[model samples]
Target: MHRTAVVPCATPPRATRRLALALAPCAVTTAPRAWAARETASTMTPGTIRKQIFNDARGRATTYPPWMLGEWTCATTFVDASFPRRDVDARALARVPDTPGFRALSVARVPDVGREGTIEHRVRFVRVDGKTREDVGFNLMEIIDAYVGADAVEAVTTDGDDRTTIRLKPRASPNAERIELFTNARESGVEGDAFYVRESFRQVSLGYGTEYGNARVAPTDYEHRWTYTPLPDVPGGAVDETNVNKVHVKLVTAAYVQGQDALRLTASSNPRGAPVPKLGDAAGLAFEPVIVYTHVSLLERVGCVP
Candidate 1:
């Protein structure tokens, strides 16, 4: 959970409630060390296996290098979105548009299915006890409220250590409530001077029904990888001319959904009485990527966190 290498801290970042997604660190075993192979803009594309070089965090709380800690303004652009599976059942893929992940794209103003949009938001990372971590609940509440509405978010709660739940007011009817659960996370980092992180999570949304009716349950997985290359804090050294202290970020986000058969099987079972059926076979276990969002940003230090 501790990092050995400490980069010099920049100026403090000021906090604000704006539109942005702050991809953060998670549990892992090894402290971040420098990698022989650097992550550059060209190499940080989606579907790349470069992240595999880092050690898995395996659901343990971890920290980032000193340079990455603090509040920053994240200016992101939605670059692409696609559902590229020809072999899967068409009927199953049809339901993808109704899921929360697809709905979020609309909220993010992704233009047409293949177009792009830009949004700006704030993110804060604090150093505690010589280790750094994110304010997860605060970030979720701000993001949901910004995209949906101020009244859309009901509560953001955390259990034990890693589990987090964001409860939202039902979008359709007052009789329903929507819940997003971040159950488990795997975050890994390369050793040394690199500021790269690859984090994945298993998330589920419930009661996210459409106008027809409330969706009983929708399970999804998300993989977020960020390749951050730091910039010098000298005059005209920043990616954004206004901010001398900054880091360039390449962020790729992918959403995956289980096959229809597995979803139906899981839905039909009773969690109170019987154990949910396991996805033992390849077909059942196959989680197809339905949406991918790629964006580049300059994280400028707005303020420092104590």
Candidate 2:
């Protein structure tokens, strides 16, 4: 299908992002040998892999390859007996049970066409690694400048092996985006196979409603993220090609908004004493949050890579 972004001073509708997430019963999916081969290539040293273990060290963030086609199966969720539930932000877990997660398949395709106009693609929610559940339509990400950045989230299950863990140090210029995340190696870890997607957005426009907040518009800038950690079957296991993993369609509707009279809080700023820089009331006009409703999915390759 053909999609074009030809005009300036205007924004396109954001794609319904489905960072493939799923919840399957305790059924193990043995990622083929290709998974193992790729993991071997990224180790910090020979015969040693820097996987998540009971340790504390921050690895330098490297400009690693983002998950493109030919390297990943669809995101699949099995019973993650080893998820890092303690690391997740408390605000994200409120009103939801602590034992919940979305381990699903996500599909992301970005053309290597360089920094030209804009990049566009769709994320679909499918079931059993086979059929389509819903085609959450494509979203648009317009470029802010010619400066594109890079980052990666690597999670490889050890196939229940006692893999040695290496200390990771923080790296400079870790991501292409202006935002740096999970910089410390201690902030990085892995578990069962599940892909959680997050988009970095830049606010474009704004308006005001009768609400206490601001009126929300589509984003002017955004980036795609597809991260999953899965166990690799090292000594090899029976490839149950027939056991299908079930799919669950999750409706992700969140708001991205422009700030109002809100002040930017920092390490030294305190409302009671030290000064804090605040945004404008803009003629007593406040805005509401931009409601973005997207979906996430989990799927596997129709055929494992050989």
Candidate 3:
């Protein structure tokens, strides 16, 4: 689960310094009355509660307690990727042998447009070798639009070269949530060969009880699965066949103890289910086939006060 890599000799240029600073922790504030009102109303039905939670412009329902608003180490492992038509095996896709460095930085509230709210997160991903080769710039997650009680949040990532957009929405079943993320990129410096990637994920949660020493479903035991697809262009620019390359699924659980100030989170994955074939080579290296399962756990502090 752990491996080490040599640090790159050179540091990032000054122009990129702003990005490094933005990756630091940030603080956000929310309207108290709005949050309290949502919590009170959510006690009715999980379905209605979820709708209300996402509908709230102030993001009151999704806000965590103050103690839960700090930096936490995050560990992610590769799961299976599936291809729809081809005979490709999902396990054969190359794996990034080294464990990617993950840091879930600042978690806080931000100004909302109209009635919708926003939460800013400074998430940084670095290569375990201590190199800045693979890094993400300042990313923003905001509830941009809502209609008839349905809400949508756009996650924008400016990676210097291109922009990646991730759209999150509530699933048909109240217990399941879907996150659709995609981007258009060039294939081989060709203008017409635009490649698109899409991922759909679902989340579920279980709760628990205290004082009486009994176990119940907590408010945050959620399971999510994301499927990745690649679309290629054909002649005439007409719609062509869609190739599904990978499917990543995970189940996460969170619990709060009677006297503890943090919520404990644990996540697991199912990597042996299916396989995805590899596409043509890129960046010089031939894809290294791999199939992996991962488990991650963390304790996040939570409090009523900011």
Better of 1 and 2 by TM-score: 1
Per-residue lDDT tens digits for candidate 2, residues 39-158, read 321232211211221224323222211221221223222112111222222232222211112100101122111112333222223232332222111111111111111111111111
Model 1 misplaced regions, further than 4 Å: 1-58, 82-95, 98-100, 105-116, 169-176, 191-193, 208-215, 234-244, 261-285, 288-290
Candidate 3's TM-score reads 0.18
Query: Which candidate's lDDT is highest?
Result: 1
**Mind giving the per-residue lDDT tens digits that candidate 1 earns over 126-198?**
8778887775655554444444444455666666445666666555223125554543544557534346665
* Winner by TM-score: 1
TM per candidate:
0.61, 0.23, 0.18
Cα deviation in Å at residue 111, candidate 2? 22
Clashes of 3: 28
Global lDDT scores for all candidate models: 0.48, 0.23, 0.20
Cα displacement (angstroms), candidate 2, residue 147, comes to 30
| lDDT for each residue of candidate 3 in 146-237, tens digit (9 for 90 to 100) | 11122333233332333233323433112112222222111111112221111111111212335476533212111111111222233234
Alpha carbon lDDT of residue 94, candidate 2?
A: 25
Candidate 2 weakest lDDT stretch, 10 residues: 98-107
Ranking by lDDT: 1, 2, 3
